[model samples]
Target: MSERPHMSSTSWRRSQPITSGFGAGWVLVIFGVLAFLLPPGGTAQQPPDPVPPVGVAPAAVEAENDQELQTIFRSEISFVRVDAIVTDEDGNALVDLTADDFEIFEDDIPQKIESFKLVKHTGVFDPDLPPPGTIRNEFDLEREAAREDSRIFVFFLDEYHVRDYNAMRMMQPLVDFVETQLAPTDLVGIMYPLTPLFDVTLTRNHEQIVHALRQFKGRKYEYDVLNGYEAAYAHYPTTDVEKIRNDVSLSALKALAMKLGGLREGRKSIIVLSEGYTDYVPPQLRDESAGGGGRRGAMRYNPLAGNSRMEESTRLFQDMGMRANLVYTADIANRNNTSFYMVDPRGLAVWEYDMSQVPIDHETDQSMLRILQDTLYVLADESDGRAIVNRNDIGPGLAQIVADQSSYYLLGYTSSEAPTDGEFHEIKVEVNRPDVRIRARKGYYALTEDNATRLMAPPKPEPPSAVSRALAKLAEPTRSRLVRTWVGASRGDNGKTRLTFVWEPIASGQSRRDESASQVMLMAMSDNAAYFRGEVPSRPGGTLPLAEFEADPGELELNVAIEDEYGDVLDRAVDELVVPDFTGTDVALSTPTVLRAQNTMEMRRIAADPDALPTAGRYFRRTDQLLLRGEAYAPGASPVDVTARLLNREGASMMPLPVELSAGGAYELSVQLSPFPRGDYLVEVSAASGDGVATTLVAFRIQG
Candidate 1:
């Protein structure tokens, strides 16, 4: 593996002032001197704009500048935007307050308000206005999410912390909230603790959200392993499992806040429905291990026995960590102008545990109950949202969640201190009018200098031309209606290129066709003559059907007909491809093939066998290992230098992959998917020779 070269000095110098130790006042002074040096009557040159503050859009920056810049001297300045909700004693929003009525302060120092706007959204669609469109993709999500009349809400259902009975009781309220509280124009999404943020879709389809909530069942205190992720840790101690559940839930909440932050700068709300979070399980219900077996019989319920000095210390440390996580999550939410509305499903609950499961002392039960409810209060209060706890009727509380998001005052200010300490800074928003209650986020975490610099840095270099072209194939529209296909071209005999065509039936549920595709009729032809035409039967044991043919290095046409078991055509597709001239004198690379192996044994077998068939499917599991094999060619007998590297979807190189030259003169790279998270990635293979250089990219996706 080789290290990427350092950024140029010019690039570093360009971003120096942003993270410089000098304050904004000094920056203004330097810019003034430069303006004086300019010719008379000339426009004062502006410095390159600093990276806009997180969650603040470029349009917002331009608007702020138009109102804030009254002098001839202007420097690159960043503004921290805050969303404040002011309501009178009767809970009516104060929408008519002007900029003069509000005073903002950061770290106890008064700051000038740079931008102010009253954001009032009813979340209702006007009858005269066109209806909102359904959110089918990222583009639609962004466009709909940015509308001022629309509000974004995501329900974070913490199934691990709520009881099954309570979850059932609350489902109707959640459904009703969607039906009556939310308008047709509002976009809503729901997420479980294990749900990926990418998988959570915000849409105008209210029925989909309700349908998902109806199936919400809690598994708190139940150790049955449901998924592969839980199976690995099902045998851990009961206390450890509780901690793990808390960690997962909190992490998910934090990620959801960040995700909402990316969608838009406006106030986003996440409704958390759970009993609450606790890092420690009571000794009365503590099992030696979660997996019930002989271990359960060995440990009897002894409430006082487990609370030793060491155990108490451990409990304290765990509680501290959990609290820190909650604070950090709140900070992120505040920075993103998002709020968390914590709803306790166990409304007016008396005991935290049931005696039927395990005997517990009254004192211990009450203490644990308070601790659980306190967690909810901390999360909600810190994020400037309401917490509905210990209440039998939560209808009004739930409605208030909507009311809070309905209207707010969006205020932006340039912190005179301009702290870059990467620490939480308190924000105080005061309205001059009396008899009104003010609610806003307590504070936000300032970006560190390094983070600011990185955000302001220039974008990375684009991928090579050949690699770009190869990646474009991944986006090619599939013409076949019943099956997916992969086509590759490599060096063939003489001056021709070897074309490999592989096909497999689309996943059973993904295809609209009733009949499964059993084979494909492949036809290869050039402008003047047909190259090859035959039927490729589908393999029975999960192997992909492949057809090989030789064609001249030029434009070629492919005709494919998908047939069922009875030989009746189910679908047809025609594609035009440009076969690369692999026999050229310049440095060249053949189409790369990706093969998957389930385990070490399978991986070794594939590595030893150079002729192993490649998988046509682009999707793979996180537990799988991938082998990328390709060939590099050069003019005459000159040896070609081949290298492999992993790249993100944006073409930024993540890391270099070591390439091995096999005995058959082929280049191979083994990538372990376990090290990579679930996302789309690319493998870049580059070959350089005395004559020239060439590169190609292979794109694949990993699934959890």
Candidate 2:
């Protein structure tokens, strides 16, 4: 692909927060995803495979649960939405179809049409929404995206396959299409094969998107050096490098289709600009040591005398790879209701190779061209889209894509057989009216047995009422939280509770100019009276001296004001707290504080120190260990032993971790970092004394 330009702005910082709305104790976890499955009528069932053993780590099981949850959620909606564009003999959209005029089926089983609606746009933007050119942030973009009438478009520029000359020629047509063919309310995004799906946001700023297209440059075969990823394999042979490039582009495209599918159950258009895909490189260009010049160097002397045996062997290998990639790509797009309109920019070309570089036979050149072009046709035809190939004027084809998006009939129905065997189910849509054609998705995937069971299972027991309320408060959304704050509680003097508040900035490459979270102003009060007020840290990016205050046992209200370097309040929040007196109880334990350490030596230092501060951030890397300590008290200085264990998000036990006594007689637990994978886990610690037990759960996420 062409190298991405360094466009400096807050665009990178405008990433949406990852939120998972599970129950109170469950947190959203991200990890490696499974491979994309092919759609129906394209591939046969492999056979009934045995259920995999459940002995894998919790991370794998959690991933399975997440996938199953998504599947079940889709199925439980009880409605399959199909977008159909009916065109008459003249190639104009026929959008006046009623619900009774459509028939839906799954695996040849007819289903009842529950709902139907006609979606039409007259090339006019909505009056209530903001203008197309006024987008400033991601929030503004999302507001426009939520509109039901808005159209979505993603321009996938496949520079890896396009020649530099072809890229330049195609830019004008694309820009013209955007400027003249699309409506102002349409939300468009620009993406490359290497662009992460999270970073691609739909926006109304058409001018900026067009400006980015003007700098398009293709890096087809001249891979010298551009980025770090490409540099790592620059010395590899050209044949191997070509195969890797194909896989990278296809994977990113599959992810993009899935992202669009999840946005809504409507039709989405992705315009792919490229030459085509080829598994086999011509023998004249294949070199074992590509940059070193082995066979290719000899080909310079006698280009027509290439080895047939070696060429045939390499061709077979490439065909297998290409077929597998094609299945996955088509399956993902069909299942997600996204169409891929492929544009081949090598227009009116006569030869695949330069005559001066490689003097190849005419038969070989024709064969190679046929195989490459076939890949493009298969992608477009299988996804219910048209392939604009073998033509010089792409204006008409580009305009047709927008027209298809403008008017369509949306038909929804409940599937008769709700299968949960994790297999592909075919879908067919037909119109009762005559002399008209129809286009729609071919199939959808069903959930697995395990996922369906969990989705139908009863809800887990709820947490204590007080703990439940506190956890619910964490679900509220915060706008660009530059800093994360935490409050700690322990025993204090004079039969009162000790409160310690800490705040730290979040480091995610999303900082603004001249803005830093200096300190926070803290205030504590009751319903009718105030307890204490103070300021922390006194400077930006500096740690505050741990201030401890005593408060009587009751419901205490906390009002916190977060300030910047100029002592200006950036955000303010109010919190409710319940304090308990430890002196009057027979056995008590403070809220366990977790302190993170990067290495074993740091862990030891933190465990031995009497005043190590707890980290406010909940995110931790796997390369870091953790030291958790808390004070357990008993009447008359009797002994109070504490034990700790790890639990999954479902509140089931995973393993028991060792708890030991630190230097100051504080109960400490050593959490090993290597055994855990990337997911949310809870550390349950319980204190045991004479006829008393107190337990607390500390939740945190480990970066994969």
Return the clash pairs for model 2, or none: none
Off by over 4 Å in 1: 1-78, 126-131, 297-299, 303-316, 468-485, 490-497, 503-517, 525-530, 539-544, 561-574, 581-704
Q: Model 2 — TM-score against the truth?
A: 0.73
Global CA lDDT computed for model 1: 0.76
Taken over the whole model, the C-alpha lDDT of each candidate is 0.76, 0.69
Candidate 2 per-residue lDDT, tens place, 21-96, comes to 2332121011012113221111212233346566887777667766675555545533456778898988888866
Per-candidate TM equals 0.76, 0.73
Indicate the worst ten consecutive residues by lDDT in candidate 1.
3-12
Candidate 1 lDDT by residue in tens digits, 1-704 = 21111001011111112111213233333433322222112233445566778899999997776445432232122357788899999999989999999998888889898789898886667566556777776667767787878898999999998889999999999899999999887889999999965566798889999999999999889889898889888988888888899889988887777667766778889999988777876665567778666266233567554446765665567667777888887876776678899999998989988755766566667767887888898899998888999988888999998898889998887677666677888889999999999998787776677754553444587766544544444442222246767777778999988888877777766544467888999898988879999999998888778988899977777877778899997767666767777675677777778889999999999888877888776778899999998888778878778888999877788999999975334798989999888877888888887747777778777868
lDDT of 1 at 541: 82
Q: Which residue pairs show collisions in model 1?
A: none
